[model samples]
Target: MQAEQAGALTVSDKPTTPMQMIAHAVANGAPVETMEKLLALQERWEAGEARKAFVAAMSAFKAKPPEIFRNRAVSHDRGKSTVFTHATLDNVCDALNVALASHGLSFRWETEQLEQGIIRVTCILTHAAGHSERTALQSTPDTSGSKNHVQAVGSTVTYLQRYTLLAATGIAVQGQDDDGAQGQKDQPITPEQVASLQAGLDETGADIQGFCKYMRVGALAEITMSGFGRAVAAIDAKRKKAGSA
Candidate 1:
């Protein structure tokens, strides 16, 4: 359900949860009914305001870049002490140029109207889809130690930087990492576990049907590896019967 710069990634490193899926839906401009269904499935949002903010962040994330930037060039010489290299914003600008031709969506920057002392560049993905008028979304500005992202779905939409994988993928995949000092994931599943799971299934005749259920990360222990074991046990009898047949 995610696409990187331009590669097919199995994405075993990160597994998205129902809550994260719901959040992605909201971010991608899902309908009210869809949001309600999502809200019911995941109780991550307790307060109404928190729910609203979550939805808002998601909606903006699905937008594609609608601005053109400068180009960059690099030159290196073995004899030179300092290498001459310059990076340009050209790629961003080229993306913006292409995004303008999409449907009736008019892409524009809204930084001048900012009263918050921060620039907010908006790409109006408008008049398309179910929207009657244009939807104006501000791209999170690039600032030191600050982060911003935008993505909208049904198109090559957006979100994040180093955390792009998280935003592009889902928050659940990045939750533990974000909580840590360094942005590194802490999922503990291993090849041995999968092998163990297979052996455990064969030995105790544990249900293999529900095994895919455990092939994911959980926010807590009850929903973690141990919980997966319980799930296998719960379906053991059924799988044993099926296997014998």
Candidate 2:
């Protein structure tokens, strides 16, 4: 019977999944038609399972949002200017791991070296059911510090990894303090603010890396409301200087 032949076409319970069984059967030279059916069933099963896992993971993530702290401060303009407070890569990951784990999820990153000094970092957030989401970001070497070539590349890679992971999870650093004002720090920048910042960058023709350094923030999107004015003003100053030069 076709049913009996179909069951016989698959591998035993050790491999478990239909796909794995199909692979095992292929290695032993199973019939093409049988393999095709197994592959089709595997595809359907995987799609359904992935959808379920994604929904469950999202629910878990929303249940308890992460609370992160600003653990590092970057001094800009020779310390005569503003200090930007931010969460370090370690602090961000530390805050996220437990929360992600509780939701049966984990994340890993892959790095690629593109042409020139560009490095691409991809964060893969996976659920226990073998479903995953990925976020990729690229940045050039951090040429600001006294870092040699290797350090510059490594620093940029680390920075991109941290941000890509957070971007994928939609997790922003949350500052906490006894003062009530610190709670307001978790508020994300609005779309209007982002548009204004982009306009400033366009006017100055500023590179994103340079703009971030000028503002003393890790990324343009991370710029706070208070920082937005300073960013625009700095860009305007640069624009004026360029115009006069």
Candidate 3:
């Protein structure tokens, strides 16, 4: 019987996976407790494989990051008109859907009213293999331009959804350069600063997406020079809290 089982296992030219082993054991009438152990083992192996697949897909997706152009403009109150452009929720979906699908990934959003006026939006990015990651951001409704209560909530939800998706995918908009208008003092952080912040995140095991949301930036590289000190301080606070814990 042992010889037959060994032969059965070795018959396949490809190396056997945990699932395959478990299946074979079940077919050979393994004991109930042994079957339970094999089942747990198989579950773990599948989860590990799914995680690895998710990482590989993400790496490939980032290799040629999608360029999302700003497609919408908003006008504030007053005689003066501000011509700032930003990528809308529709634009983000149109830009990322095809690319994400090609890499076996998809994203969805969940919204919750955390408080009377505050809304939390969570973006869940999932791989076809079953691994998933989430990025969430909370913000109050936008009452600018005299928007009504419903419009204000809708606007805030849309805004949070757009940002959460970008945060999860680590994507930034390639839009018209308004930095000249904002002044040199508002320039993005240097490469060295970005590297330092990245190292801090790694050491502290902080969520990059959450950090980006907290900093009001799409990505670490988009953090402004003026905000570098604050970013460092935030990381330091997290590190100290972790240490004390």
Q: Could you say which candidate leads in lDDT?
A: 3
Candidate No. with top TM-score = 3
| Candidate 3 overall lDDT versus native | 0.80
- Write model 3 residue lDDT over 40-153, tens digit each, in one string: 988999999999999999999999988999877765435654456677789889999999999999999999874345566889999999999877665556665778999998
lDDT of each: 0.36, 0.73, 0.80
Report the error of model 3 at residue 56, Å: 1.2
Could you give the candidate ranking by lDDT, starting with the highest? 3, 2, 1
* Clash totals, every prediction: 20, 0, 0
Q: Which segments of model 3 are wrong by more than 4 Å?
A: 1-15, 78-81, 176-245
Where does candidate 3 have its weakest 10-residue lDDT segment? 176-185
The superposed Cα distance between candidate 3 and the true structure at residue 157, in angstroms, equals 0.7
| Estimated TM-score for each candidate | 0.20, 0.58, 0.66
Per-residue lDDT over 97-141 for candidate 2, one digit per residue giving the tens place of the 0 to 100 score: 998999888899999885544576888998888888777665556
* lDDT tens per residue, model 1, 35-132: 88778766543344444544454454435433222233333333543222222223433453344334333233322222222122223232232222
